[model samples]
Target: MPAPVQLYVYDLSNGLAKQLSLQLTGKQIDGIWHTSVVVFGKEIFYGQGISITSPGQSHHGRPLQAIDMGETALDEETFNEYLEEMRQVYTADKYHLLDNNCNSFTNDCMGFLTGGSIPSWIKDLPADFLSTPFGAALRPTIDNMFRGPAQGGSSAPSSAQPLASSLLQSVAQNATGVQGSTSSYLPTPAATPSPPLAASSSIAGPIQICSNTQHFNNLLSTHKAVIAFFTSHTCPPCRIIEPVFERLASEKASAGVAFAKIDLGSAYGGGQIASVYGVRVTPTFLFFMGGKKTHELKGADAGELKAQVDLLTYQAFPPHPHASLPLRATRSISLEPILFTQSVNFEAVRSRLFSFIDLSALSDERKKSIENSITSTIIPYLKNKADEREGKGKGVNTSISSGAVCEAWRIASKDLIDNLQVKDIFPLADLLRLTLLDNPVAQWCSTTAAASGTSPPHAILERVASALRNEQQIPKPVLLTTLRMAANMFTQTVLARTILVTRSNGHHTSLTTLAISCLLHDDSLVRTAAASLVFNMAAFYQAPRMEALRSGRRGEAEEEGDGEWEVELLSAVLEAIKMEESNEDVLHRLVASLAFLLHLSPFYETQLKPMLEVLEARSTLLAKLEGVEGGFTVSKKEARALLEEVGTKLCG
Candidate 1:
């Protein structure tokens, strides 16, 4: 008997009961209260009840045993009757049962109206609940110290007590039907509170939030925005505002204001992400302007959060309101017309986002909602731009303010490049197919720069490259061409960036392969460019690649001679390099690249003899062209020595 199973039911929604007793609730047990179970009414999280008693003198004397000795369920109405009956049947022995036996678990709060001490269990519940990591990794890790020892750490365990309680309280109050103590009851949420809104006209305060470029792209595509709070459980100010967020997420769900929370990475020194947003403390709120960041709030309150949301959503998130009033409060909101009017076809995108009326939270549904919102708003804008170029007369320069000419080129001829697809892993082919080699998305990506008030083509390119690098699926050619063009035009970035990106294992190609390509290219610039990346990429695979070559040649006579593969590959590389040898500006990367290749696999032994002969002949020919004459000069001499060093590395 845990002090004889004395039941104390309390309702937080009603002030009198809450004041009379501390509340015990989770979504499993919210607003409704009951002692006697009736199918379903709210008596959740009743973990196994323990029959606590005075401990025996032995160290492991079986912790308090559980017994249903006086277990009872009371529905609100029946509970009232039960309470009345209990009052009548109350005796001195029951009071003694609680007063002396269970000090850790108290019924003291049971004597409510008059002040009484909180039970140890009530105080410890939060820590115990947090200790269980169920459905919680994605949730904000509010506390830095949440990992401290369970009970013997001397100091009190860190618990976002107030915030946790608020979260529990809201969930409990909103929940309607819940199964009781029995394990076999079918579970289902009878009535779920509506989720929060996705719009903001500005809840209050001038705040700006900056998103990484990818998120910026997604938001602009959907014509949507969000207010995010970066916080931690250990942060005092964050702890204070978390309750405000829980309250706001529920109360203003109908307002279309979206609220999100993020916990900084653990390595960030006690949640120091505020530094990126330029705030030095916890509880920083930011308001986003379109996809760009607008302002930051050093501290936040509920009113401020809600108001900022209301303000941003009304003024920024939506595209245009419709002509007719909705018959009911709908999950969808009209986009503001101002957004579409600026760009002739942007309106199509607006209608698209408006079509996503997901009033649910299943993962698949949520993914569809986000995807639909993006395609609807963005595709139309792209189409309109396409239509604008209908008859600009072939060869007529199409670089308007939006730069439609080059885009028209990519559109008129997309077949030159291959489009790739990976089934069921979320199709990105559609997105890649839309990429124009003459640079439509990058240019439109440039408009994002206007939103950011700076040309972010390089930043955008870097982000795209970063995304592409890790993509295990081969990238579509049009996308590669478009990015390559962007890299070229952004001259400051191309060489170093291409080299930087080439080293990444995202879809690695060997230096030997590129060297072979450069030797055979049609254009000097293209060949030179490929050769440069080959140099850097080879460094990472150097010795291992060299060893593989040596091993492949060791049994040349016994080989089935897939020599045609090597012959074709090397022929292509040499042709590419020979074509680009005209550009003196690229000579260094060429020589250094060749040097890098020769350094890895010796020219005489581990390679196709014909390709090396072709490459050396081309180099010797280039050296003879005025100052470009080449007989593997002193520099080439040094490079060859380094090659010798690489060849002898294993022997050493």
Candidate 2:
């Protein structure tokens, strides 16, 4: 069930800004708004980083008013995961007064929770204040008040007299802008303290604060490598190296290594955590691998610390198999999805499509309606989209609506497939191939699911595949155009990945049926397009394999079925390689597809290599290479090298 969300708005000036802002800045700013999101009985806000407490009980005290902001379908666990991602971007060091603040944080949370934004006045307060003459002049002074030594290159000025004298101090103190404590905008003592740790998961950027033994152990067990920093707030040396520790965490945490900080003096269980690890110093670093301490460094030495971190990460994740390969040409190949983005003559295409329909078996009424839709809606939209893509759009108001295009596609696809001849369907498929290049139309087609009255995502791709499979001999033009359309589906990566690997009503969809069939096509164009589609699929599975290699969790690929997909893709690719004789370009693409599928594959040892041995993949490739005419080109040389590397290194 969805939960109610509210925005807790506070007046950072304690209502004094309202009375004095007109005289001080000559701007009638109502209040210096500080906001927090209230949901699931927790008041979550960003201050010394993100904090969670009982509703209306954060250090800001009770909010002046709580604005109800609808509800969210997202559950707590999913929401927390979103917050974990945000922690990387919204670290304490990144906070700013007018730039990024508590209100901005609440606004972001509100959008995630309710698909809505906070009241504009609350979030726009800073901009409004900054636009004033006096406010503009004081921007640097105000920013310097909160800037720490690491950021400002000097000790932060005392908030006591930040503006030089009493009058300036009073105004500066009242107008501190947003969240963190500049000595002026100190947090009011809360009746109840905020939770010590927002989460135990390994998030990037900020140091992961561990408050208990179990929490610390959980971080260690989950990550392959962890660096625990023992520190205390009272120690000056801890402050000196804290920034270095944070910078390294940001750099290395994404690679699946965890960085934890345990404060020896704290109300939470940080002291207990330090005691368990026998840490008594202010800035001690302990490197743990597989939850066992391997190295330790006391005090701050930035160079040695970085060296140790690099050593630990290297020991943990190591390098991917492809890293050792010397295939220069293949390494330079771009993995971007092949999209058909030509600004084709929509009027000419529409006329050709009408002529094709006229020769088809469609009823007269259906023909008239379809032609009218092509003339009035889809053509205009495609034209506008083309103009926009070429930076020729006259203005925003002249743009055509995408909703009309989606509806027209539904009607045209149904009518054309149901009534037109298989050979004549190329025009319609060609039109859709062009239409799918438009981002709005592609996004809509990617996400729309089959419902009581709606068509499934990529229905046209499936329809085209069905024609190829059911017909005795599909038309070459139709097959080529359809294959191009299938390749274009990778424009939306999630849509292509999800739809291709999935079964609909218990049968193979276009991926296993259409792409696999066209893989060994007699026509090089059709086969090249099919190889592109297959490369997209291979790249999808290859991503998790790479992540698994980086994080020292190679077993995860098997558990998640990534290995199964690689084996299935490779079997078809190997068959294609055996039959493919000439065309270096097609062979190069096929070899690159193999690289994505076979490199770092978890099934390499158990399933993939055994299959390769049975098929004699190396001998087949060598035989193909032996037939080259004069000499090997750079592409063919790299292609053979890639194939050889796979056969010897991976399969051996």
Candidate 3:
């Protein structure tokens, strides 16, 4: 049976409350109203406090209206889980009077339950009032008044008179622009929503059961890789592999592997589909890629299934370099802001940034121009480009705008490096880093060709790379930040290919050379970041190369100098592993990168023995050094399993 939903609305006062508040408090109270969702006959309310109040008790002599919102198909467990997630996002501490308040919570719940939002008039009341001239002028005072405490305390307004007056005062304050933190008022730049859930077959845990042949084929076609477990209701062996398959699916979902089960005895076309696939036995497993069968197995061997799935998962999407790394630092690293949608401590970061550079040579006007360009033009251009890529905005011409922004930054960067005797390079690199942090604008700028059919974006990156390579006195933080930004560029396949294949003056660009140089840097963090870059570049290149090879388009012909670079990268990683001291993060990245490079490269056999030897040595030492006061800390069992798994794959 579908679960019932009810929308309960309570007006704090009649029409007279608004006029009284304006005359007494000198502010317009749009309306003092509260809304809640009642599911399964429980009256749930969210405000300064969340409570399940008795249905009639919540009205408090005020006018009340209840609307039947139909029913929801969600099971109790799924609904509870979703509610928990909603609780995290709608935390009471983060609530604001005008922005994310009781109404916002109600709208979210209503949408989730009924697939429709509340009426727009009530939703837009606060925003509409704040747009007026008087509303604009009174906002600060209003925000300050309500910022004192959240409403609905244990010492609540008991009588209808006090409750109505207090609620009216609260709404008036909200109308005048009284709110929470400063970040609440600042408009978050809009971006396109992600593609609909149906477009991607990326699953998070759980083995999905396909209902019919069409369903099975659709999942296979949309997903990069799919593993189908064919079973029958009466087959006992199928039960053995059920739990194992679920566990493996959960572990590998993040790596882009999808798992499904088909009961051949079902009334759907499962029997016919199994016969077509030549599944003569129960508990048969079939692996598919690009709608073609790649591997098949009979019976229910959990170990073999795990190994095959693990191999296929890595082959599809390489593991994140830090996936297995155990945290060693007491505090986590602060993430850089997405300037478009996030609030940043601009003044603090800028003050620290200025101390690193000597601006005496450049006039105050020029310095201000540089700062203004970054704050006003460059940030917005990048933000817009990011939004456009995600299928958001009015389809702006980002290629031209982003190119201009990159050109401006390139000029500013060169000027600073030449004119200013930079006291510390870290701050400057950090500033540049923040601009491109996870925003693919840098890569797009580099790869997108100009009207002359010449790449201007490459020139910008080349300048940054040249500075890193030639400036021997550059601080470690500066070098690290520069390399991180460079790594981010390789996230785009075209940019990665350009970096790996492009050459200047009979040599690879300094950017590539700098990455290689950092592979053996004395600092562990630098080494890990560099290794991650190499892994990303190799993974991006391998996917298409492998596909081309499978299609017989690129037959066994390795790109020029590819082997040499792979060997150099592998050697550097092995040496880093041997030299690493108590840095689990470095060890994890090096191992993960090595696994990717080995599997993807043609030289796996040649490098296998030495790689295993290094791992064995490290594992032995790690065993003894485990839990020894910050000495080589890691999940020993996971480390051992990784080594064993890699060894088995190599030996086979």
- Candidate number of the best TM-score: 2
TM-score of 1: 0.21
Best by lDDT: 2
Q: Regarding lDDT, does 2 or 3 come out ahead?
A: 2
Clashes of each: 73, 0, 4
lDDT of 1 by residue, 1-652 (tens): 1122333333323332232111111112122221111112222111111111222211112223222224334234543343332221121111111111122122211221112222334323322222222112101222111111211112211222322334334323222222221112222332121222232222211111211222222223323355667765468877777767655543332112334454542221113334545655567777665556666776757777767766676565232112122212111111110000112233543343233223223345444544553444334434544455564333322334234432432332122112112221112222222332224444343323322321223233333344445554323432333233332332211122122222332211322332343343455544444544443433322322332233221111112113443345444534443444355434444444443333323332445544566456445434323243442233344433432332233111
TM-score of each: 0.21, 0.61, 0.39
lDDT of 1 at 91: 18
Backbone clash pairs for candidate 3 read 139-176, 142-178, 143-178, 143-179
Q: What C-alpha lDDT, on a 0 to 100 scale, does residue 588 get in candidate 3? A: 58
Q: Residue 5 CA error for candidate 2 (Å)?
A: 18
Better of 2 and 3 by TM-score: 2
Better of 1 and 2 by TM-score: 2
What C-alpha lDDT do the candidate models reach, one value each?
Answer: 0.32, 0.63, 0.51
**Tens-digit per-residue lDDT, 608-646, candidate 3:** 445556555345334433444445555655554454444
Which regions in candidate 3 have their CA more than 4 angstroms from the true location?
Answer: 1-344, 352-368, 380-404, 417-423, 437-440, 448-473, 505-509, 516-524, 545-561, 603-630, 636-640, 647-652
